[model samples]
Target chain A: MDELSLLRRIRSEVDGPERAALDRGRAALLERAGAEAGIDARAGQGVRGTRVRGMGPDAAAAVAKRRHPVRWVGLGALGAGVLTVALVATNVLGFAGWRGGAEPAAADALQAAALAAVENSDPVVAPGQYLLVETDAVYGNTTNTEAGDYVSYLTINRDKLYVPADRSDDWVWVRSFREPYASFNAEGEALAQKSYDEEVAEADGVPELLRAPDAQFYGNSTVPDFDALPRDPQQLLNYIYKVTAGGGNSADGAALGWIADTLRTGVAPADVRAALYEAAAGIPGVEITEQVANLEGSTGISIGRVESADNSRQDLIIDTQTGALIGERRVELTDEGWGFPAGTTTGFTAVRTSVVDSAPEGGTQNGQFDREGCVDKGNGNFQC
Target chain B: MSTDNEIIERSLHSAGAFAEVFDRHARTVHRYAARRLDAGAADDVMSETFLVAFERRAAFDGSADALPWLLGIATNLIKKHARLEARAWKGLVASDLGRVDIDAIEQAAARLDASATARRIGGALRRLPAGDRDALLLYAWGDLDYEGVASALGVPVGTVRSRLNRARRTLRIAIDPGAARDEEVDHGRIVSASPDSL
Candidate 1:
């Protein structure tokens, strides 16, 4: 979908609760407004600030906490993800066309995926080196506005990915934006090469490996921080739901996506990978599909969820017999008309990953003076 | 209702006049706060927003759109809540459904997909940088245009565009209809340290 429409969808979801909150909150605010103006001496009804008119902030906050409606607590913010599981499970109001399956059996499939993760030995590198993997990706889809004026393009990107020697956060990526993006013009003519080219250039400067929020970047790549991740199924599941992923995406979907993404790097420790699958099983919407998917000609068993945000289904293709993560993809089942049509392959990645002894010529060590400061004293255990 | 600027200008000399300002703009501020925060915290924030605005009326820059200015102040207060009240509000989301219609909520919940669109948006918003997300939310829910968002954010209009643009793209990646396909888009790739094992 187009950016404007997406923004509208996002706004609509938040707007309803906000408007309701408005209805409930207005009376109390007017009372505070009235009290501040000293027009309502009978402020006992709505004015509930316990601290005096001008207490210092800390004291005022303490009083506010006390006066805060006691009935409105977060069910104690339970650490077990009880609320998260309940929220996801209960809120799955069934709108997204849930397909009935032997649902509980899907959990067993996930348990098997975790066991496979435990046995997986992808790669391990010594310090001062990086892991490099390469693949071709198509990043985004098309979107149209109400007036029929549309903005959309699809990119064919060949990328080489690199990460720290250890499972550290940051690394480098080299992207090649190839020609002939899927396109059509404002007038509906085919060769909108300029628009396609602009889209490609928009991604040209994206340092492949990057961080969010701050988006701190270097010349070729960026580093990410994933240090505080949980290693247990429940906590990891809770982390995805209550911590990182919230109302927008399913906890199960996000966890599955995250696990598949992390493992795609071929760098996570086996326990972390195991925990990821175990956590993914805790999500309520999970189902195993009988269909097998082939991306870049690698075929695997498909298990997926109808990911909420776009009414699209995300399938994780796994080689169940051998326990290999072949690949993953998201397919739009409902187009909503103005976006990519239904059955459009919105995204796909076939990854070939392995660890190497050193950074490529244009990678992490390129911008710096040198790595590790290899200064040495004479002994074997030399002090550098 | 009097114009917001008029309400603020009148309140400069008369303390009681601030009530009119509250009556005029409280709902707007409350809705904006509610969009960013949970319901009960929104209530506290809504009241505190106007209360503080009233106390600072003497310093009111009356030339600007008063609601935007108020929203700006409300935005600051919400940030403070985001930081200080994170734990406080995190413990209270379950009980905030007091005013919601269970039947309507259930109806809306019908046929809910595991990866429902709203949850994805929520998840994506959480992933967004606080600065960019603030700009986008202000524009979306705070009823602010680019200038209004700029005014609310205390940044240049260009900065608001940049932040909103960044936010827009990030959210699209999460909510876009096409994202569900191309499984590769989400799996994120790097390399195995021992490719030779193959």
Candidate 2:
């Protein structure tokens, strides 16, 4: 190969900083910009003094109506749990006006899903029973070559979490990576095979056990009492904004993403799930992104909001028949930075929650084991 | 649809407009930084690069694109952590040697060959003069042409060409000295000129 290609290949394995890092950088820049614009980001009220560059009268009016000041902090304020839950709010607020409101078809689909959720039985974890949550996910993975440039492949993963009926009880998670589903280029295919081969050769493809404080997916704090959250869709959205303050890119996107996060845990009650769907219906820029979106072989309707800044769409897939949240998927609207064509699925996850009799056994594979879910009672009584 | 120059100019009046610039180039800057430094340092460099660019936007030369300007800023910030970058390169070279196990696996053989070449290139990159390295990487890793490299380095195109030629010779020899001698004789002389205008 030519020296130029060789030089490019040197240290080419490194892709861009992760989504969180890019957001942090953007947040830092915008915060400085907000300071320069004389906006009180902390107060969250800067409508009167704001001067939105290149925006015409109507666009500026929409900004004023929202009363959303430019935020300086990146999604860091949301903390890791909420950030993980929201999956990074696509499309900060100011850009939503350009996309207009939710499509009628999209609104109708969400409303239907809401009604279906209400009709379903309430989800409850009975005593002595464990909540088993399984998710299969496929997303893009990029690797650089010694020949210069980088290639992206579809990485597959499966995670199983067993949550006990008691909040304080131990939780066990099994995480595993599978072979690649596809690749954007030849190099990516080779790299994916190499990765899969190495994984199989080293660990014998055993799923590693993950122990945590609780079985909350994405490290979200304890699941909220669905009955406690406001039932009214508008009030619930407002509560979401208040709770997720200084986090995410835009208020609408964050609200929608907050709903996605809450539902994906596979624990929200029927009423709460219905309310979240109704809340999502009101979000501007909401649309039916995909009619037959498939996740782990399950097909569903993909409803999403676009983060216009980067042209990425964050989708929440809902099974219309059952009103159940199938999973979440992220799509690239345009091939700008990502080396894939438009409509490429950048990220995806399919969740399945069920009640089981007992939790799985744990070993000293990744770390110290706690006696395979055995519990100690008074007088050294052990139940294994 | 606004040109990067237009966006930067607009950002002067409406401070929030600067975010468009960040959206457009932050990843590119971060990727470049990551290639040169560790992930943590790369994040800092990416953040700092845009902050510095925003602060100095008033002095921007109104170029049609902002990537060259942003990368120039990132290159300077990376220079501040030269020691860390050198150490990373040294580590990569060391790791390459440690992988020469006689475990006869055909699957890993091709990767090993490529990895060894990459390590050699990394070592050679560390040894190159700082100016030449910057000029070469800006052109190679940055995907910038001769003029883009010149603009990123704030040097004349002529200087960029010379540095690139010198850097290429060093890399060729590092990758394979025997092939380098024959290739250099066959090709007459190395040139940095690309199809893009300088």
Candidate 3:
């Protein structure tokens, strides 16, 4: 009475009903396949007829031909329509935008003063001091590319700035405006936090407490021999950037120029300004009306703008050295959509910065800086 | 005049010809599916199994019996559909009491002391780690030799041997608890003592 025999008998008994059910299921599947084939044939006929008659193609071509004229006419009519709609929507429907109202100009000046105090104080780059730098950028137009909107943010860390060779030592703590929908209850948060803690603990010389379930060996174990480690600083930076960007690895030449620039001058590089301009140009609805250099110094360049792609006025900062983007703060536009009724009015704001430390003490803070003034700042630290 | 291989090859060229391949392998695929998953979902798995195999026919090496390749595909599909596998196991365990053919168990018990052996084997199999269970099942039920099992499980041959040996030793100790303390027992004897001894 071996396990095999017992299993065999049980299998035989159960198999009967299964076989019958399978027969019935097969019949049903064949019937469904026939029905699907019929539907596919009908769809094919419809597509072929439409293609031959050219009705659908002709209509689409006609629309394409007349689209610009229609859009221009619409834009002319939109000016009056926007005011009435904004009044009705905001006053009656209570459609408050995602952007908040402006603080006092003095408050902004005070913020600048506070930032200047931190920057000018020759503040020792601590493990977690939030660094905010400002820069100005010129964006190029790219309305034809598939990229829906030109969006960019910043990455800050200790290892990224200082540590050039140690793979084990580099760990990023936060990214600026990186996670759009990150919430406490998200499924991956615990896993992400656990990995973060483990990396931090290992770097701090604490015995790694929790090995990743899929990890082959526990703490300080070198990656397997066959696995190729990054050989250069740029490759390492690309790896970190890939992780930070969450699969959106858009580190093209222009973006790389900004990174290289940030590394060199502590200000975002000149090419980043051009790249940002290019990104802005790709967006469908926005137009850059004006670009002016607000401040020029060894630290960075800040651009004060009259209007942006969304028709909301903005002030942008571009770092000259690092080519990393520094900050973008949108001012409320007075003309409201600027002759286009459907244009967005909500303003946007962003700031990017990095701090450098010659020597860092080990805790969780060894090689990273904090990012402030990001819209979703929780714990007042950027989460890259 | 057609070569023998060419004639056999030409016969299997079309979608209809490939559908015959499906009909021939469907039962084996269904059986493997039933073993890995539950009866309720086996047909869908079988259909999908063939669909994938059909799509990948251009890549088929055409040197081996397609049954094993089909089974491999079925195994992967089962892994992807883990919830279905769990449900099938649940259904099997729940229905085991009413469905048990006592005569068969008793006969198997007489030959290999199956009733007590089954209890021991079941306990040991349950206690064995996930990797070990997978190794044992792939070897014992899937009828894959060590090399094939290793390739199927994406593990080294040494790992497969270690896992199988560990599982067999554990089952032996469970069957006769007194054997747990033995120091110099032959590994071959331990493997032979198991109810699944080949």
Candidate 4:
């Protein structure tokens, strides 16, 4: 059949809005229309947020959450104005058409990984069990001194998140940090050592544990509905493009990074993971960067996209055999920006997820987990 | 039986008169919004579209039919949640199996093919450029003609035609790759030849 008729037939399946929805909309409209006409709309209404602007209650509740800036892990606020990248590096118009000149190797590998994900079932977190995710990461930490020169070093972070199957139950998080190595010269090394010493001293007697009491499916408010995510590969890519719009140097790079970040949570269901892999296959410039990649001992194939702006590449390593995201890494392709040599690993994270019976003790006992304003860092520290 | 222009004009003086416009077109606006986003978001969009239209009723362009203008407003509102709309389309593409309505024998044929065709169309719709997608959807789902689409998108009639052509061409390719590849290639040469001629 022709495309237009096909589209019509497809859309014909969508039932119109329910009567209640129409009534709610009409009521809201009438309330506002009345108020604007100098009529009082406040008769018999017990107490509600002033609908002077006609905002529904849900919109009102979403306002606070929406005001909090959306943060993508591992990709801090990337400034704009780097719009011109290779056609393959941006998802704006590239790869929108059927695989027009995109590397086939990456797409093939990702498709295979997606199929593997569907075959392997997700770990069922039965009632009374906690899904424990342990992650170890190394990130570049830099601090500028009064003298104008900056000291750069790699900081090591290790954290374990214990999420009960019952979302309302208490969730525990424990984290620890240590400096592994400092690069960029003698002065940078000395400064890194000093900073680490101070952090250790300050954290003395401060337990690196936090507890969230009765969090409604922790991170639901922050994380979009994973189950509701589009499962089709092309549509999933479109969805990712929408979420990661204007995020990083390259939109495609940011999307790949976001997938790695979401997977690092270790909470995404198997179907979502499969969809994510399938979606990643649709991104241009996503290629098998490494055939046999090893991160912290675990081995997997590394799929990566290079950011043309900074000459850095973000790599997500996936075990094609099992469809598991083993690790993620950022490699500085050139020394132009960070003065790091080519192939220098600027940052990397290794993830391990398992179901645990209990959470470790010594956290802030019964500290109510605050979802407003503070982010639920898998690492115990909640950065506001 | 007052014209939409008359209702909107009178709504300026009598605020309650605006409800007539809502009563007349709320279902249409809601359906269009539901087609773009989900029903949940459609409620907000429907209510807010009317609210915006009511607040700006003084600016009504005195058309007999307010659907084009109302849809224009709705298109803008839908742009804000373009991501969610794409997700919704993706959802349709991913799960379109048991939703087909097979009532009769002829429809059964279409119904059997509906699942695959729906997925292909859904994928094509999401991938179309936002402007092209909007124009095509306004034409297809909103049941707007060329002039009506132009009015809704606030674009020239020629632009709407060209966008529909481009969008339909893409969808055509997605639905029947073997057949449309030659057409796309021929069109590509013509497009590239224009630069050379210049």
Candidate 5:
């Protein structure tokens, strides 16, 4: 044989070690990258802010040098986070044991959640009556190094009111406040409250300073006709995957995101809500976090996926005892080299919906209360 | 349906996108590392290579496929274990000595023998300059063309040809001194320069 041909044959022999190498490499690299992406979205409020921050390393370096204005995912947080899962193929009503690799406590929790959802009656909304959705939604916490003195922490809360726009494809958004996770400047002034309809309307790209009779809101893009969603779990999961495929999220991520999005709308159809929970049981990487989410003042258990195309986990807070969605949170799993630190709550949407006749004037405001669902935000600690 | 570059672009905006990049190229990069190092160290080196690739993905040139870039990184990291590679080569060459254990059934299908010559080639490879060896191994093992080798080594295409020529000449001399001849008249070289632009 030719000398060159011999060399080629010898080189080909190295293929022996490749399979084992790929197996080891894939697990480690993917875990870190995958966790970073999924957890960031789940934990942080600033989706755009997080992406923009990742693009600029200088911003991360700036935080690293400082005392780190935000909180990070600690061992305690990870420890407290329940990696519990429950699987039942036939019926969540009573068929226990491992139909899949399902944990009993987690399984019971889900079954109870499903049962609660089934028993709870859907609130009736009449014509001209608004399905008032009050949420202390923190999009994300950004260090306001732009300002001085005591490091003013800014976590812009989206205190919104979603009223149907004459029962059509459109909806009205009345953002009542931009409550800074801050304290009083003077006596009788709890916090600097900015309740401007124009600012909220403009932020949502409504163009008008005030809500017009006909204007499309930013969040209206994801409003689904629940009547069309399948009643079956696997079918619903497929539907979510198919529709959201063109978007950024993975199939697992899409399912998690869709559930949160629908619940936040504050008008999830009763039938759809039950089916959605059942469907959630089938998605891989989903776990029951031991977090009792506080939505303004109410509480619920967090059950959702910690997977994403980014560095955060998206959790849906539902009352296992009552099947009501309390709120949703995003927990950052890895730093994503942005140096934000793991376990940071990147973004959160705390939802509380109440049916009311006729829209309240100026909109419903955030009262003297705190929203502590997953992580503990002690008094005066306003940001992540 | 997204290309690696497209997936990387989307990964910048979304979390799952980066996983797609890993899914596509991790195996190729891993096994390539195994060729340079033992299977155990290859696992670690492959992990390190990808982690570096992911961290620096933002600076990645969007027009290129990530495999050559990834293979290049693997080559650089593997350079640290040059001694391990040398030992592996020497041991394999030694094992090739006085071995006539080719099965009758296998021999019936096999047409020729090149183990001793290949063993000499392997030792000769271990003795080349790190850059030249990188170029050679990339060509021989990376399945990279001239352009790919160049890009992987961060050298010019012309330089890649020179390194390959030099690497091949050294091996040729070790195998058959008279047949080694001059580097200029190696017109018999079947190297596809077309892939040099990759």
Candidate 6:
């Protein structure tokens, strides 16, 4: 080989150490860059600055507060309280000397009224008229676009008088679903409302994708354009509350109050709780066996029944105030095609729904109700 | 008790400790970059190279040294900023113009053997295709191995070898056309085959 060719071969051989060195150098440089970028690489390392660049300080603080152990413990305690109530309501505790098969006076009265409502299929608004309606009716499967099949479930709730501005008196129906682990504001009130219209608007020019069978669409798409519908203020309020609650937890007294004030032009706690319970009972697979004597002081409700399709027994604990469902444990026999041969325990928390109710007065309003009323001040007003 | 791996692990986890890595390898990287681009461009390129390497540090395999990886990132960045590199070369050539003198030329000629060696190396490099030229320079001047050149070019080891071989052949012709003939004979002997007797 020529002297230069020989030299080149030698050079190639010598380059390995140099290449390794360069690799080492680059790795070190990247570590420094990560540190400068404010990413915590080491476990158990807290972020040094209170503020991060793109996201503000408050957002960072919120993340830290959400991750705190003490907060999680408090939520756990709340879950335990709801569980206790569920056990008591299901008569698992047997505390009130209430035994089975006597046809309790409360059940007899509610059953008779419920059966009458189902037969009439007309709205009833009496103060003590609680109805439990069961139907084989089909509900819109938000997840399945192609599998549009009806499922059987029970419905319960109070019927109220609705007097829209442009229509005659009509019965406005309201119901609440149980949601567990719902987020609340500092004042212990649920923040269930979507604060802005833009928050729900899809970006322009993006085609909507088909939802999977297991996925749910919880945005503005599910809400009805009630403003265009002619109805009384009370009817509008009931419709608005039903639409806002979105088949989720309606147990939050504040959420109920907001609905009451928005549609009825008034806020009543007793009416709100009654509406919430009705909504909870309307959910598919939900069955209300008995109404406890004092619902106001009750933390939550427990229901036991065989699920309609699978005939599997399930127990559910629902938060009474927040309408949040918790501690849902289902046990199935006969090896149904679904996995969980041993059955499964699931914990569910309520996610904030993206739908927001526009103020009836053509301005923005907070979707939450405090103690006083709807709290609709003007445009862009949010409950503190 | 800190082992080598422990030190490296600690350095990987902490950015402040990376200075030790820099203090150890920066001079060599600076020199390599200086050879590829001008000093000013090299500084910026080196900084950026390290910055990118730092950002992707989690992907590092701790068993290996990290210098070649840094150089690979630096090489890519240099390619991205090609115009800056051209300007740096232009400036280098322009500065050479100011130092040109008749006496200096005579003195340089008097040192023909040494000048010839440098010119031959440079001419061999310049004759190579841009890709091979880069591979050759990184290997010869930067002292990177075949694997290092492959890493820098993001190519395979065999490709590096082929490029290096082609570069050396081109260099031999440029340095002395007669030398090419000698190389063909030597290659034939080494491979146990005649050039035309295949």
How close is every model to the real structure, measured as TM-score?
A: 0.43, 0.50, 0.31, 0.47, 0.44, 0.32
Please write out the lDDT profile of model 5 over residues A235-353, one tens digit for every residue: 66555544433233454665556666666656666667777777667666667776676656778877766564565778778888778777777766886533245676655767677
DockQ by candidate, in order: 0.09, 0.24, 0.03, 0.20, 0.17, 0.07
Return the lDDT, model 6, position A146: 23
Judged by TM-score, which candidate is best?
Answer: 2
Model 4's CAPRI class?
incorrect
Q: Would you list the rank order by lDDT, best first?
A: 2, 4, 5, 1, 3, 6
Give the fraction of native contacts in model 5: 0.39
Rank list by DockQ: 2, 4, 5, 1, 6, 3
Tens digits of per-residue lDDT, candidate 1, A29-93, equal: 44433333221112111221111222222222222222111111111222433334444532224
Of the pair 3 and 4, which is ahead by TM-score? 4
Find the 10 residues in a row with the least total lDDT in model 1 chain B: B184-193
Number of the top-ranking candidate, with DockQ as the measure: 2
How big an interface RMSD has model 3? 12.6
Better of 1 and 2 by DockQ: 2
For residues B1-198, could you state the per-residue lDDT of candidate 1 as single tens digits? Answer: 346667577554333345556555777777677656755677777777776787677677665468777888888888877754344323333222223234665754532531255556666666678788788777777767777777777787778767876776676666565653433331211221233321
Instruction: Mark the 10 consecutive residues where model 6 chain A has the least summed lDDT.
Output: A135-144
Docking class of 5: incorrect
**lDDT agreement with native, every candidate:** 0.51, 0.66, 0.36, 0.65, 0.55, 0.35
Report how far residue A151 has shifted in candidate 5, in Å: 11
For model 4, residues A192-221, the per-residue Cα lDDT tens digits are: 577567645645634356566442223433
Worst 10 residues of 5 chain B by lDDT: B92-101
Better of 1 and 2 by lDDT: 2
Residue A322 alpha-carbon offset, candidate 1, angstroms: 4.4
Candidate 1 matches the true fold with a TM-score of 0.43
Candidate 1 chain A lDDT trough over 10 residues, lowest sum = A66-75
How far does residue A300 in candidate 6 sit from its true spot (Å)?
38
lDDT of 5 at A30: 43
TM value for model 5: 0.44
| Alpha-carbon shift of residue A250 in model 1 (angstroms) | 4.5
lDDT of 2 at A177: 53
